[model samples]
Target: MEEVYEFLKNAKTWYLATVDEEGNPQVRPFGAQNIFEGKLYIQTGLKKKVAKQMLSHPRIAITGMYQGKWIRLNADAIYDARIEAQQSMLDANPGLKHMYQAGDGNTAVFYLKNAVAEICSFTEAPEIIRF
Candidate 1:
């Protein structure tokens, strides 16, 4: 879990894939990530289409590349309604404070559960981590 968090933190900009209402895949670049209560969490606005998609379909995938290596993660996005969870994410990513607050109705934080991530590079065998 720590390894995955480090890789994603360093990667800085990962892509999150969600399924739309029509069953089509939607992918977007995301930068917010953190570990809280031993779970990997991501931040977004509740009003965003991505959040709506995730609410309807919890299964999602994330992919990011850094330094010639890339990570592909599949997980269930569980929304955490607790303020502490929101605060933790905002604390980790201060820039989000400009647009989000812990108790703001628009702010949404989700923890990734049953996650399996594969880190791959052409020069080396893939490393798989589960959390």
Candidate 2:
């Protein structure tokens, strides 16, 4: 989890890579990545494109990259079951509330379960392990 934490904090933003049922890969840039209670959450609305895509295909990849340096994460996503976590994230980031809030009164928040992160230092070619 520490590596995951480092990966999240060090990278400016994660590029979320998702695949449609027909195998079309959809990649989007997301800015809010808050870790709470040992879980990483990406908040957004259910009706949004990514949310709808996740509902159909829960498997996704999130990657953080810079100047050939990167961390590729394999994760399983689920529509968050708890509102407290979502609210907590909103509380932490007051500015993004509008982005997370859908006009119809839906909160967009989801958890990426057990993100197994692979940190790769491209300049070195071989990856190093650190916790």
Candidate 3:
């Protein structure tokens, strides 16, 4: 879990994939990430299409490249309605405060559950991490 978090945090920008109602895949670049209470959390606006897609389909994939290695993660995105979760994310990413506030109703935070991440590089065998 720590390795996965480090990879993502260092990557700065990771892509999140979710399935829409039509069953098509939607991919978007995301930069907000944090770990709270041993859970990896991501932030987005509740009004965004990505949030809607995630709500309808909790299963998702995320990938990011850092240095010469990349990480692919599959997990269930469980929405956390608690203000503390939202606030924690906002605190981690202070820039987000300009666009969202805790309990603002538009802020949405989700903790990844049952996550399996593979860190791969052409020069080495893949390293797997599960949390």
Candidate 4:
């Protein structure tokens, strides 16, 4: 889990894939990531389409590339309604404070649960890490 977090941090940006209401795939770049209470958390605005899609479909896949290596993470993105989770995400990403604050009605945070993360490269075999 820690490795996944570190890789994502180093990659700086990850593409998150979610399904729309029509069963179409939607992918977007996301930069905010946080780990709280052993869970990997991501932040977004509740008003965003991604948030609505995620709410309807909890399953998501995230992929990022860094230094000739890449990672693909698949999980059930469970919404954590706790204010502490929101606060943790805000604390991890202070820049987001300008756009979102803890307990704000528009702030949404989801944590990856029952995840399977794979790190891969052309030169090396894929490494599977599950949490």
Candidate 5:
């Protein structure tokens, strides 16, 4: 999980994929990521379609690239509504304060569970980590 978090944090921006109501894939760029209690967390808003889709289907895939290497993380995003979780995410990403406040009714956070992460590079063999 730390490796996954490091890759995402270093990349700064990653694309998350969720399945919509009709089973179509929805992909969007996300910039906030943090690790709390040995888990990787991502933030979103309850009012957003991505959150809704995630609630219905917990499986998600995230991809990002940094320094000619790429990472792919697939996990079951379990919702973590605890205030501490929200605070942890906000604290890790101060810039998010502009869009969301800790404990706000609209703010939602999910931690990646049962995660499989792959680090790949054209010049090196792939490394796979599961947590």
Candidate 6:
């Protein structure tokens, strides 16, 4: 869990690769994830195309690098908008305070599917590692 937070915090930007209903890949860069109690929190516009994509195919991939060659992870994204959507985002980034108003309009969250973190590195061999 601590490792998860560290990786997410260090990531300047993450590539969210999702597949459309037609199985076409749509990759985009986004930065709005917060780590809470060993969980990763991500938010975005509900009207956005990614949101639509999630509805069709909830599976996703999130990746980042750590030590130039130590591939940080390949996460299984689980789109979750219910259960702590608003508070979790604010707690994670805190910048959302300025983005929010008297009413929380941008209140949506995505949970990592299966939510497994693997340390991907090709130092010597091919071993599937999970952190």
lDDT of 3 at 64: 99
Tens digits of lDDT, candidate 5, 1-131: 78888889899999999999999999999999998887889999989999999999999999999999999889999999898999999999999999998788888999998999999999999999999
Please say which candidate is ahead in lDDT: 2 or 5: 5
Candidate 6 segments exceeding 4 Å error: 70-76, 97-105, 122-131
Tell me, what's the RMSD of every candidate?
A: 0.5, 3.1, 0.5, 0.6, 0.7, 3.2
Give the TM-score comparing model 1 with the true structure, all chains together: 0.99
For all predicted structures, in order, the TM-scores are 0.99, 0.79, 0.99, 0.98, 0.98, 0.73
Locate the minimum summed-lDDT window of 10 residues in model 3. 1-10
lDDT of 6 by residue, 1-131 (tens): 45655665677676677788789999888667776545666776666788778767877777666565333345455555455655767666777667652235445676664655564566744334343
Query: What's the lDDT for all of these models?
Result: 0.96, 0.72, 0.96, 0.94, 0.93, 0.63
Ranking by lDDT: 1, 3, 4, 5, 2, 6
Off by over 4 Å in 3: none
TM-score for candidate 3, residues paired by index: 0.99
Instruction: Estimate the lDDT of model 4.
Output: 0.94
Candidate 4 residues lying further than 4 Å off, grouped into runs, are none
List candidate 2 stretches off by more than 4 Å: 66-68, 101-104, 123-131
* lDDT assessment of candidate 2: 0.72
Using TM-score as the measure, name the better of candidate 2 and candidate 4: 4
Q: Give the per-residue lDDT of model 2 (tens digit) for 2-117.
A: 55655665676878888877889999887676677767777766667888888788888888876567888777777775777777778766777766643335676677785677
Tens digits of lDDT, candidate 1, 13-130: 9999999999999999999999999999999999999999999999999999999999999999999999999999999999999999999899999999999999999999999999
lDDT, candidate 4, 1-131, per-residue tens: 99999999899999999999999999999999999999899989999999999999999999999999999999999988789999999999999999998888888999999899999999999999998
Better of 1 and 4 by lDDT: 1
